[model samples]
Target: MTEKLNRFGMGASFVPAETLNEIDLGPLKQLVGEWESVVLTQTDEKGVSKPLASGWNVISVPGVPKFTFEVIPYKENLKFSTVAVHAGNRGPVLNGTQFDQEIFGLFYEQQIVSMCDTDFCNGRGFGKDTVIHAETGLLLYVSNINGGYNIARLGTIPHGNAILALGKSAQANNPGTDFFDVISALGVNLDGSIPAMLGYNDQISGIPQFAEFQQVHPNTFLKSTLDTIIGSGSVTDMTVLSMSTSHPDATGGILNIPFIQSNVTATSMDATFWIENISGGSEPEILQYSQTINLVFPSTGTVTPIIWPHITISTLKRMQPQPETNEPLTLSAQAQSNTPGVPQL
Candidate 1:
């Protein structure tokens, strides 16, 4: 029987295996299933420089898994904005956009992958990453938005979908001040532009464009769905890595974005798992987990790092597929198919 791991997080040390090159996946093996995040919050440390205030108060959808990870092909594409000049134009006019898929070309290989594709994190504002780690379990989930916003990648779009403005604009400060524009950024009209979330309510009310974590509609709380895996071991086993990289697409080809530069990385995972026990049941029957993701972006020549503190709460359940059958199934047996991920070989 497989031994169950109870917990895992930052501060744990790595013990090298006898095999020099082999790596153990740890509790991550049990993470290969569906889950749901019941509650979540994404915040930052802006108070030290300004006023103390709350951050994105959002949640995810349930049942229909919103977050997923798998053995996926690892690759990245690079895009550059091109322009067509008129007869005598010194400044370039419009032509079309050019893209280089896998600019840092990579061979097809399996990697732990995660992406924000539910209610939030979609195009121009999408978030996705392929993590790499040394033998010690240190990992970095690298990705650039149109470029990227590191901290909020898993929560809400930090600067919204305004990639052009992100690289050129300054970071916002505290509590509705000019320092940080959280409100105005979230307030953007459905069109994706904004005075931020705060200004959205003041300028336009009752419109779909004006929304927040508390209210997606008249009475509904717009929840962001999540299906994720948590590490199993001790709280000290896991940590965050904040990183950055350079590619034409990383900064959405924003003004003077470092067309070529060095990349730094920042990343870490905040997680908690619990087991519920009944008065007289079979060794604690239920397991659940809550995790917060800290993914930061590569900095542009002028822009500061974008941080995304993505969070999720999900219930855990094992869905073991029946053993593959060599013999043909009877009519009744064929009716109920086995769940996905069954061993076929």
Candidate 2:
């Protein structure tokens, strides 16, 4: 017989050790199955900014009996424009002719690992630091070789299957702006003699010809996918280092984007976005718009536990001039919206 502690610490009780160990784990076991989610990220370097949604999932394996984390990103289609001084002394005018451009794209399928001590004790884990470009459809997969071990592969999965799945979904979903395909098809089209002067004509004129630009389509690119399994206890104790944007173009002015970090013991998640204005002359500004959403996880077994308890935070920031002063300046503002979620896990 085994002694059982009273819930209120008032009654004396005894129970068999074998009975205690025989407790049904069906509920927890069902909750540990494989899962897949998608996240959407959008950044407007032009002027108008949008929000990025990140998706997370956890899966369980038979042998290890641990949890593995996977993240997938979807890109928000953004369309906005800003004026630029083509020639010298030109006044600041709205250039509606500028083709729609997207500053950032959907994130790649990244593998997250759980670091553990003694394979099940206490440890920490981090996600891979690589990002996939939405426009060029290029996958810049970075491994442990480049002075960074944030993301590593514990095993290998079939490449053909993953590629096929990624391609089919990316094409079927078409999660980009309406004009994304249009602008991508027709690159920066400049008027006047500029195109010719830049030697963009045929060989006879010493100018370059617009042969097939060999534009990289959005669907052909493929990113690496990896998975890691860690002990169950490791999931409860998680920390977020910092959330950031990937390689941003210099064409747009200053940009500020807001992101949320989940599973954080702390109540707040902080994020910062950096932008460099290579458009020349003036600097850019950042404005922030925020919103929140409630999330609910599906119930599992008899007594299902809520895994994600935090609210989804979204923000959008851009560069603009001071309304009152009418001076060339940068302004940053923040807005927040909140959503509730289940409080089990």
Candidate 3:
């Protein structure tokens, strides 16, 4: 948790004080329960842009919790319903919904939380704003608004500057009021930072370059090489050839290189080079290339994973069977039994 206060000077009259304990946060907590917004950057495949509305559900849990934001699609009549799980080590589950089709293309969503320490005297005080600084260099301003009016008018001040203003305003309203006698205050040092919401950029894109070659044996060598290429973070495309050959002279030695559409950017130029001696035969020789080149993306677009039917079927088989039962006997016991009968005699 971050420290809440700075050291005070010996002669200072007003010291940095705790603000959370002074004011009631019930109303503020209630106000953050559900929030909705429409994002204007969402677009479709046809390059058509549309507004996408998203919803959020906030909750406070034990310890410092990282809030979550969820994206929900619009259902009938433009309403949304979705949930966001906190990304921290352990936090409460937050849910959200988006029923407004006007904002469906928005991908990035976030949740924010705030804490205050003082009270405002019915909007008449100076301590009306709660200012919070985020680790990402973002500043947040939170204020109590009631029925479209600032809550300072109601003598409400939770934990920030507004609390002092409310106290002064209250003193001015009543003459002969002792500042120390009438002023009530509390302070709280909240431990978390404000959430920074982000969204996907439609203008950025990536393409993958892959190498495909035939194999001489059904060994793990091919698969291992494929894994190594991907793990290197440079190869974006891969294809395994089905053949057995050791020399480049064989028809099966043909290598096919293809470019795959990808959303990831290449981290290095190493992927552009092919394994010189893939066959690993006696007196192995490296394949000479005329030129090596790295392909760049010619246009901006996004690439989503294409779900194939075979992959889906394989995943379903991994799930455990429900309401399982043991196999029954195929033959009846009586039929298998032999007895000394008159016909046999």
Predicted structure with the largest lDDT when compared to the true one: 1
lDDT of 2 at 31: 16
Per-residue CA lDDT of candidate 2, range 230-322, in tens? 111111121111221211321111121222122211121122111111112121211111111112222222122222222111111232322
Cα lDDT listed for each candidate: 0.23, 0.19, 0.17
- Given candidate 3, what's the lDDT at residue 120? 18
In model 3, the worst 10-residue window by lDDT is 309-318
Candidate 3 residues lying further than 4 Å off, grouped into runs, are 1-6, 9-23, 38-345
Question: What is the descending lDDT order?
Answer: 1, 2, 3
- What is the number of backbone collisions in each predicted candidate, taken in the order shown? 60, 12, 49
The TM-score, computed over Cα atoms with residue i paired to residue i, of candidate 1 is 0.24
Taking every candidate in turn, the Cα RMSD to the unseen true structure, in Å, is 21.3, 29.7, 35.8
Residue ranges of candidate 2 with Cα displaced over 4 Å? 1-270, 279-306, 309-319, 325-345
